[model samples]
Target: MTQALRFRLATPQDAVAIIACVRAVRGEHYPIRLLYAPEELAQAIAYARLVFALALLPSTGEVAGLAALEPSPYGRTGEMGVMMVLPTHRRRHVADDLRLLLVAWARQHGRRGLWGEVLAPVADSPDAACVSQRFTENAQLVPSGIALGLWPGPGGERQSFVRYARPLPAKASSKACRLPTRHRALVSEILGRLNCPVSFTADSPASGAGILDAKHEEGLRSWVLAVPRIGSDSAAELAGAIRRIQTHPDVAYAHLELPLAQPGASALCELAEARGFFFSTVTAEPFHDGPGLRLQWLAQPIEPNGLLLLNPLARRIAGHQSREQERVRPWAVAAAA
Candidate 1:
């Protein structure tokens, strides 16, 4: 950025300044609630749960811009976000400096990648544009998935947040994955791109009942329904869960995850697709119980060319998902007509 600023990790003492910085743009609308609570923000910094890269005016000691990374409890990846550069600091590369600092920190922590959602640089503002996508792309991150109808946006509209990721340098993820016949090609392509090694065997049906780990993001009204271990009963239970979530007025999205190495995963994939889920992402670990596949269902239709997918592969994946969503949810088309 400008030679006027210096960059460093923010200490707990800087919590109040961070809140002031956020409030200047979002007031009470910032989704990161902790940023508004000085005590909680300070605690997060102290505990290292919220790692912030701060830029300051070297001469005045004023906070100029900030970026932060929240490590996933699942490990291997961290969500990098809360990117804010004051209007005064926009063009000077302060954001670029903060982003690079976070990426370096993530590497030091043994993270495989940095992940974030496409959102306006200023939180809770009416203009939910694609500028966030361009910003992440500027940081060397590419569109890895689309989180359709992820959160409530301005005008009571659901936000379709695109997922972005930057893969750090690492060796192959030696994962043994059982390929679902219908999704083999897509999964293979994703794995190849990630330099992941996959070994497949004859598909065998799961003998026991499946186990599901369900989590709801309260702020965003999004649900992550992961079937780490799939069994004969997974489809039935998962279908019930999906149906329940879909009917909730507040629920906007459901992310269905199935392990690639699980035999019953393929059947569950078919079942979920039948329920209108479409491809979103393929992960190896820390992102999910990976190497696995992620599918998503949204309450709203994604407009044509809605997501600004930055890379060729990401665009191809989005196009395939668009077609697949229609194929799976033909009833939706009929109902609309």
Candidate 2:
């Protein structure tokens, strides 16, 4: 017989069951290695501060299936992880039920949207993708984007991750552009001089951030220029800037550099969440790159991986929520069907 599924906030006591579930579902549909280690089990529990776990009961309280709701960086956003249904629980729609429970919780808790990434298993079995595909379909999560990365195997196997989203029936508003009061002219100069392109910084209360090397900071930092990269690429520049921000004593919170793709944006957004920055708003469209070149706002954070829905879908959800809440009460629930 199919077991009844239930959901609740996970407690420390649930660690044993949770770990067992992880083992059962291991190596199937996730980049589990990046997020967990044998010693990091405690860290996982700690990291899941904003989590809700789903389980199926054989009778009174035995877990037969399980999934977790862990925190995401971009303010109220959160991620669904380690969704596992034991072999016996297969075909029961427990995954769908758990996802719904997680979504409902996010809607109520002021989260803007939900993001999920699915990985294929190492085995030749099609069951992994089969089950994940069904779950995404039932949840109405559109395959809006993909992330490809090389993994160990023949032909340098490329793992595929699909993106899914669900907006609350209630208002899920995002942040608006706040014009900066300082550093406009200086930033304009740098942009004009470098022929810089892209809205690379978040909306600043003062002048928006800038892209300055050490020389730039040494000379014309009279205003608040939200610098892009002190070095070449996004990662190195961000890391360098973060160190500078830490030592400068004059600088405030740090800035960001986001990749434009759904998966990249989501990954960077998760990093932002771990760091405790609130996502503000997302600036997109053809951004100015140089004198004659431009690039899409792939990923640019106001504050380094700070709170902001740089993702288009997520941004929309946040904006919609905020607008609806503005019209009425933010927390008023819609009637159930």
Q: Give the top-scoring candidate (lDDT).
A: 1
Best candidate according to TM-score: 1
Q: Please provide, for model 2 over 218-274, each residue's C-alpha lDDT reduced to its tens digit, 9 standing for 90 to 100.
A: 221111213231223433444444344434533323334342211123333332333
- List of clashing residue pairs for candidate 1: none
Model 2 misplaced regions, further than 4 Å: 1-6, 27-39, 56-62, 119-144, 150-156, 168-337
User: TM-scores across all candidates?
Assistant: 0.78, 0.47
Model 1 C-alpha lDDT per residue in residues 1-337, reported as the tens digit of each score: 4558899999999999999889876678875567888998899999888999999888877788989998765547778778888788888888888988988887787777667887522243444455666666676765566666666777877666666666546556566666656566766766665556566566668878778889777667778898867878887899889778777777667788777766776778777777778787776555454576789877666642455555677677777777777776774333223
Candidate 1 structure, TM-score to reference: 0.78
Please report, in order, the local distance difference test score of every candidate based on alpha carbons. Answer: 0.73, 0.40
